[model samples]
Target chain A: DNCRCAQCVNQDTLQRNFDTFAIPKDLSPQEISPKNDGVDVLWSDSHKSHYPWSWLSLTLRDISHKKLANQEKLWGATIASAPPEVRFDDVMSSTSPKGLADLTSKIRQYGLCFVTDSPKTPEATEKLLETIGPIRNTHYGGFYDFIPDLALADTAYTNLALPAHTDTTYFTEPAGLQAFHLLSHTPPANKPADEVLGGQSLLVDGFHAAETLRKESPGDFEILRKVKLPWHASGNQGVAIAPDMAYPVIETNGGNLHRIRWNNDDRGVVPTDIDVDAWYQAARKWDEILKSKESEFWFQLEPGRVLIFDNWRVLHGRSAFEGLRRICGAYISRDDFISRWKMTNFPREDVIASNMQLR
Target chain B: DNCRCAQCVNQDTLQRNFDTFAIPKDLSPQEISPKNDGVDVLWSDSHKSHYPWSWLSLTLRDISHKKLANQEKLWGATIASAPPEVRFDDVMSSTSPKGLADLTSKIRQYGLCFVTDSPKTPEATEKLLETIGPIRNTHYGGFYDFIPDLALADTAYTNLALPAHTDTTYFTEPAGLQAFHLLSHTPPANKPADEVLGGQSLLVDGFHAAETLRKESPGDFEILRKVKLPWHASGNQGVAIAPDMAYPVIETNGGNLHRIRWNNDDRGVVPTDIDVDAWYQAARKWDEILKSKESEFWFQLEPGRVLIFDNWRVLHGRSAFEGLRRICGAYISRDDFISRWKMTNFPREDVIASNMQLR
Candidate 1:
């Protein structure tokens, strides 16, 4: 008979051979006692075994099929009632462990979340970023103010309607977390009634939309998954930046959605080898889902309200506004967000035990 | 007796129980014949086993402990000798598979390689990059001309002596392959006999140096590998760029060295928490090894010659010179280089067979 101790079982093969009765009945522990960091057990065959708390916890978690803390909770329009939000004072005062854990959990659940009652200043955003990690400075400086400047390099600088899309698609590794805080908004005097009606911020659950397409039309999803598209960003005139990157619009790892990169303005000329007609058809369908009322969540950001979202999984846009509006924001890297998550939300014994099963 | 057919043998456990006598003597093949893709064994028991040539080849290669094509070969000054080089004419006309294969082999063996007899033009370098993959356009643009332009954003634009270091350390993912083609070189008029001295290109095998440190001073090596250091690159005046990154000087995966990033000028202020004395001591030792004659290979680049090197593995520098040197080059991503290598040097059946043993 093979040794049926916890350490003897090959972790890799355990999953494939998993059964409720995989733990042999003949090897059931006769006496079990908890030790300082583990448990000591006497088996029916008189074999003694010691299992660490971590290992036992992880095993039990795996057996229960519970999801890890970081795995995203998918959502769509039906669940997109009010945008996930927390009080600014709560996060600002989250120096205590419990407070920070709550804030991090909120951000993790909803790709986008809001903090109300934030100070209407660029420095406030910088301070908020430091609570998590350092600012990820790109061509755009850290904690930059966004005002309508025709001379600016990016389209965001103008008061033009932008379709829902991720930012910095041209970057090799696009920015992860993006925060936008409206510092001030002044409705233009003598503005046409129609002009003032459209400046609401728009957000779409890209992962949800991708999953819908994958389930409804596998053919179109396959085409998008297999094709690579180019992205380019000419540095603002006199701003030494000329960034370019190429990747699939819908990126996946092991068939799980990883990221979504879609910026029409920054898209480079498509390669001649790809089937242009088919690609356009597939892309149009994706755009339809992105813009559909069933997929989009809209809100008009007011002064001192900060909106933070996962740039990799959420597409954000702004409607054209005929007014003097001022906003400030900063980009944070994915690695930093993950690091902060781990620091603030220490994995419980159960989660660690579950991961051990996969080891 | 249990069946001893090839299919019945657990491939994963075969290596652990490997023995020539393990095969049943009574099941000796009555006839062995080679098929189009595999060998068919007609056992005395009337059972047939077909083994694919790929699987057999991979198994034998693995048994012999051969390194994969992509794994690098480390070298020091004693073996530096001449940088691996090929004729530009040969590479340019390498439409034939064999010609391209040989060129790729040279690059794989030595992280750096040169091509002589290249046309002394900026377009020539661009053409060479296309053979591998599309150019990786960054702030410098694709196939940039490198002249001593004071108006430029980077320090490479100045004729000052540059210390041995990797380029674009501030990037989250730095450029992979960097190519330099000297288009023209004009020594300054009335140059002193001793002043004509500078401008010899310097190269250091970072992997070699790192390995050496790991052998001689494990403590310092561990510190360099484990600690994260910051890198920064501010854009030139009015140029919109804000570059920042943090990573270890020596990066590794599963204990194997992956990449190296060392740029003194762009280094950010060290974090306050680390042991300052210990870190500086370790960093100083690392610098010494990089500058030592035993670790460096020097050469004078000339027109009609191109130098291509793995940017992640090699540290390049230039001595101060009073001359008008015109150079042009471009960056290629690591993915592209690997793709070209795989396309040109298709592993033989035996190699594939050997790898199958692992699976």
Candidate 2:
């Protein structure tokens, strides 16, 4: 037989099983008072039931309380700063749980980070990535090495002056964490003097730029947030995987900035129904904000250094280079990075309960 | 100077360029008649603009006609049958575009398909996949080989009965196409004389089951469609990649079935606020429909054959087996498969315009 405690028995089932007064027509307690770690319930049936506070607390917490709220700290161009850095070896070799927790926390706060003195090998970069989460294998193989190849299918494989953009914008779900390691950089054999000075890596805090735009020009920001622009990448010659996707330039979920997708080069035909002139004006303003020095972090990646950042929040680019550069990198899915963060910090029960309520 | 055609010119700018009557205050046609492959537009300004029918057709098609509509064929247990199949060699070696078009069309029409006579090699399977699209690399790699290893981290690598479910449901965007190629199978070393069976692949048309439930039990179907359930997979023991995601069991976009996520094994803790008994009853009913013979297709996958199916519509599983089985497989992103389908059939302009209007 099931336990007869008031908390364990279903009131409706009990009403059917017994006479009205035997189980109490109204199971609502006639008198209730807190005891030592329990509640004493005096029923109309002249029967009493004792309920432990632990069970009551667990069962009533969701209905009795609001979800825990954490406001995301939004930054602007003037407020932008360099991402916090950690030694590559410290992240790879640290056995202390606090070290990993600190790294993941920094990633969540700053959307970008740098690790120096990493071993100049793809395997080393991959091993370091594992400390955070699994490598997200994409069309580009996991832990892929990049070198200038004339036969490259993507623009990233060339030595051109790239503009600020997010990688794989054409992908419905773009890679989350992009990790780049500069394995080697040798001056080009027949390099032009002017070209030798270029090829520096560029980083832009898209979130900061977006937040600034939202405050400065709400109309432009709203257009970018609502208008869906088409993005496309041609399948490699002789290959049959030409992907095309359309999404708002700025995306939000529950009033929180979710993602930013911008790639002028990969952009496809604009829809004819939208006001082309208005769209252009809004897009230009956004581009100006994205490229402004206040929103940019420029640095030349040296050998044995790796850069990892949130692909959704940060836009990456590189100036033209005339050099023999060898780089290795990998992509991590967003869910994996978030999972690692939750496991390192939040309690599993709390995370699940909060997400359930939000949904 | 801008084109003066009503369709091409910007109305706001045009008003400023010319006097009201000079350019025609209202370009509404006085007499619109079709000539030889052209339309004669007699404007109120006494200006006649001869517009080619093709241009007029493309521009006026929206107002003049309804879009092409194709109803998706949904099948249930009795109506369900084995998916239409093609030979692997025909897909790989055929020079005709029709071959690939037929395959992709079949996939779109029926959520699953099998290619017979595939060479018993991982490379062959990959080559055939490349014929349709690039391989979608995942945590498992570009192409992964599976063999029974006692130390395997995932349950899929072991010889256990798998419940009908979609793969990678815990990922924010689950893989689109799952391709499986059975490489080899050997009887277990300790097999009993009477136990000479098992290890057949199982598939269920999740969309069919959902639609059936929608008709038979609207309340249960509604709950499944509206309730967001948390899904989680513990990082493989010793591995660092664990993913957690929440999505409704049944999802739709613009009244079209978009995705189905169900995995009892990967389901996380249910929320406390929901009626536990009611949810359990609804879930049990769904499971019953999913497992019913009417919705299931059972078959033994032999070596030298590959099965490819949509992860969004078809749920895959396997019966417990006592034998040595080796399999190789890879996941293709949904965007890629859709891209291939569109390229092989639908015109890009038509698709974009339709999507824009829908939004």
Candidate 3:
């Protein structure tokens, strides 16, 4: 019966103790008593449950439905004019999680945000990230701090210009939140700090671009969402990573933009079994939209400014640079980051209702 | 042009260096020269490229299409008569990877396998798992070897019977492969060695069960596939894990069964906005099929034997037991395990073709 009585469900774990399949079909409540804030029910099987009115209402409608429609604020280049920014000290020292909540909210709405005046060391940056969730360790290890040493086979390890793209298209579930801190970018020995050139961070709201394509050409949008593209990362020795299930560039959930797994660099050879020509045409248009001047948001990363962006919703890259540049970053897994966000923004009514009903 | 020429692509990394978006829209091949085994082409843009006949054919027809249809051999309780198995010494000591290859193939086709004569220690179990992929760390950490001490809040930490279910339904990408090795199942201090009761390991081929449901009631199967259900794990302190996107119980890609995310224990409250009555009816049928004797394969775990199963396709459980039972195991991430499998079973033709073409 999935009864919520103290004897049926564990208050500490919130897990049902009775067999769910054992409940008789067509089982109905023998008695229902309504209180001021809740209702008590005795099932035909003699199991009792207390359901708060608020919980009953919540069950009637999923408050989190159409998540993107309610949360995200789609934007283009205009977003650069007033980039989301929060102070590191406030985020770290606030007694209440107000500053952290603000930062996470900015990430949800704009897909990216900057925390300024943060410590410039990798150790400090790692600690800052741990405040939100655990760092997801990959083959590259957790909390990477590198200086373009060409230690790895991937282009990210070299001082090369990278086009606008989401990271980890090869991953089954790509990293959710990525944080980057440019600890230092020193010029050559003979030159001054101002002499260091290029190396500007690029951010593009992929959801905005995808939506534009949807309006511009529905056929192209359909192609992108239906054509599964194989992606791989075979650069590292003895590690040929590829998701067992290849994914379409754009993934939709209940007709809402859920994720964008686009990376030209990581794409495998396109198969000719399907309409390859149509896919190319659609992908080309999508790429053009992503690279357009109106869609691109460029910014110069600073020593004390840490940028955290949603990898699934935002495309990020960097322009080629000169001088000795040092950067540190890490990926927070999607489940871990979302868990923290849900906990932080848990509905007030649901919390009260659950506390009262469980008690 | 996405060419594989020496001057265009990096041989070691196999990553294209040219700007894909810069290719002219009207570009075409100016000339094509055919060799005995390959073809050479000169493009309108003065780009030279060579492609092997094998590569060209592989592209025309996706060799890996309908992956499930080609790989899996579904079964029910009949599988227990001749359960898939391999020896541990052969897997570890063989100079060639034939034994390991056979082991992985069994996992792919049968969704599970047993490695007999294995070392009865957690450290040895960890080493055996590493041969396939890196251990996926979670909130509980990695390589867990535990007794029913109730150290964690989850029911798994207790001696209660667990129903057949896939683990980590709350994970964004559920763990791909799970390994379990019984270090010991000693009888209570006074009981005889043969007196240990119950504790039989239960396994069910979820794909087989879902297919049976599809044949029996297409409407119910459709309901299971279309209705998204929320799942969560909030039993532990300071941790409440739930995926950003809720998934249906049955997930199919290109009309083939891809994955099964079923766990009654972890499911959240059903949203009443959907057809709750219909969903219950459909889910009840699914539960019946899973719990049916025809769908179950039960066996008692013992030392010197390790069981590894695909978490995405197989449902596992354990019967309630007495005595000091100790088990050790770990989860291998989907990406990592699949990568190893792909590399291990790489198509021979593609290999020779790539070598010749790239050279």
Candidate 4:
């Protein structure tokens, strides 16, 4: 006998004022009155509840076939020819939020986007991010603007090539979104502009690679999905960070592949208790797919341009470089940006109804 | 083929310099040499690698039986008599860290602890939390200290009693640890000390309740664990927080129950495709067990008594009251505090071995 009448719930706070648990176990509907759009039910306990037709028809209705799995636009090297992009100035405009909305939608569909003509300073980049959500703070601090100073123990701080992997695999909930603004990448003074080499950024559609593996070898995909692997970052002083719960390399939600965590460097030693050989074999197939020519998109970052990508769905890497290169970026928590996106794309009424449909 | 020799890995960065993917697929061990503590192998590629004995023994070794599940000490109403506690000064002390160590251990095993003789001020409370880890910032901001001013739209801003439930169900990764410091609980100006009732706090061991349900009804437990439910917090202005992936009320890691996310008020409308009747039945049983006398530990908060609990494992609630009460507290991220806990409990060498064994 759960009631949702105004008397039972406070409109201001949206919290229940009536005791739901106190309702008798035998409580049943005393009367049901049909309405144009819904029905009103009077319970034996004298409480009332209103259920719309939409909610009433949902009982035993299978929504799995309507999942948003295929809604995403998976891509690979082909995406390099036509990258999704938006002007930085338009996104920061206060009068029209269409630019920000477009950027968010592009990231949602393609897992990555570029903001061209952005300011080449760290402060401006941080302000641009704040327009969407708060900058997530970590042991490394909130806004990162640095060169290869070797200040932190991560390989990202060194001028070395990095394999395609997601950052912060050690975090229990790895960062949801990551951004990189290449302020400047000065070539060696002795070398000509044409001779300058290395430092090309790599982006891989993890979802696309994952789907390939699923179609090519379902058994290998199953092994990767079932095994929970540990990761860590202990090189920094007094920071032996490790998640309490290890996660599989692949994670699914509502029967759809959602996240991929692949970092050979941060991956901890395999526990002797698991099927080590099988795990390795499956991981090998995954690696092969990630490194395939058709799976990789390589491009050189330019000044005054910012790149944002979904860390949960995309893998990134960098070739070794020599020069005074500076990059600025920050991590944004998933909940924050998702809130902004929904508010921008969906109407307020629709949002509330969807949120309270089953409640 | 995955060689981790000194030349292949940098000692300072702990990052592999060699390309593990470059090793030929047909490469195999040419010779195997046994050492006292480990073994050495020479590969067909003329590469040498070492494997310690401890690392070698983990393969196919069933560590599930050796799980630390039993290492935790679950409790019920009896905990009210002798709750795990520590002096505030002891935890904040730097000379001898035994006090902080004890507090961490108690929280790790029992999921809750009380810090007695704490300063009755918001600043002091925030400082106390920083001794353990950085305060987690959220939409509500960090270190909450306020009265029922309706400044924000949340049920917590009222004096009404709340059911035993976890907080922040809408978050993708809920807060790991939460602390509450009751600065003052002044009864109605006309009420006397003995008449000052109905402000006691409630605590329920979620793990204990889940275990009870598992034993009492396996079918219901399975439904609760497997069915991913939606949750949302759309009351606040400009904030419609909802996770991208829905999670079950009960979550397990490595075949053991690890987290409980139960907030009936925050739970969103259930999707129509699932077995709605079965879910309701299982949830009803859960509510019964949580509200049972054996599962609840009630206590009145004193000005100087600070209560800290693992939000992932414990459910908290409060009783309705007519009074002016002020509470100050903050959320601590999982990675921050877990890092501190592991560092305090395990030796540094063992920690390194555990982190590096699989890599």
Q: Write the per-residue lDDT of candidate 1 for residues B260-348, one digit (tens) a residue.
A: 98876555434445785677667878888998889988888988878888888899999987878888888776645654564466543
| I-RMSD for candidate 2 | 12.7
The TM-score measured for candidate 4 stands at 0.90
* Superior candidate under DockQ, 1 versus 3: 3
- Minimal lDDT window, size 10, model 3 chain B: B350-359
Interface DockQ of candidate 3: 0.33
Clashes of 2: 1
Backbone clashes in each candidate structure, one number apiece? 15, 1, 0, 12
* Prediction RMSDs, each to the true structure: 21.2, 9.3, 4.0, 3.3
Model 1: how far is A315 from its true place, Å? 0.1
lDDT tens digits by residue: candidate 1, A124-223: 8778766655566544555688778755556677687877889977666787789898887776777654565457898888999898889888888888
Q: What would the TM-scores of all predictions be?
A: 0.48, 0.75, 0.90, 0.90
Candidate 3 segments whose C-alpha is farther than 4 A from its true place = A64-70, A93-95, A149-151, A186-194, A271-275, A347-359, B66-70, B93-95, B149-151, B185-197, B271-275, B348-359
- Which residues of candidate 2, in runs, are more than 4 Å off? A1-82, A94-100, A184-196, A238-245, A269-282, A344-359, B1-72, B78-82, B94-99, B134-142, B147-158, B189-196, B217-220, B238-245, B270-285, B344-359
lDDT of 3 by residue, B1-359 (tens): 55667776666566778777788888899999998977899999888888767667655444444221236899899998899999998778648776787788889899999999998999889988888887776777777999877658888778779999999987888889999999987788877878756788899999999999999999999999998877777776656777666688999976888899988877776555679888999999999999999999999898989999999999999899888789999998877776666556665345322222210
lDDT of each: 0.66, 0.67, 0.80, 0.80
Segments in model 4 whose C-alpha atoms lie over 4 Å from true places: A1-4, A13-16, A53-70, A186-198, A271-275, A355-359, B1-4, B57-70, B186-198, B270-275, B355-359
Please give the distance, in angstroms, between residue A354's alpha carbon in candidate 4 and its true position after superposition. Answer: 3.5
TM-score of chain B of each: 0.77, 0.78, 0.93, 0.91
- The global Cα lDDT (0 to 1) of model 3 is 0.80
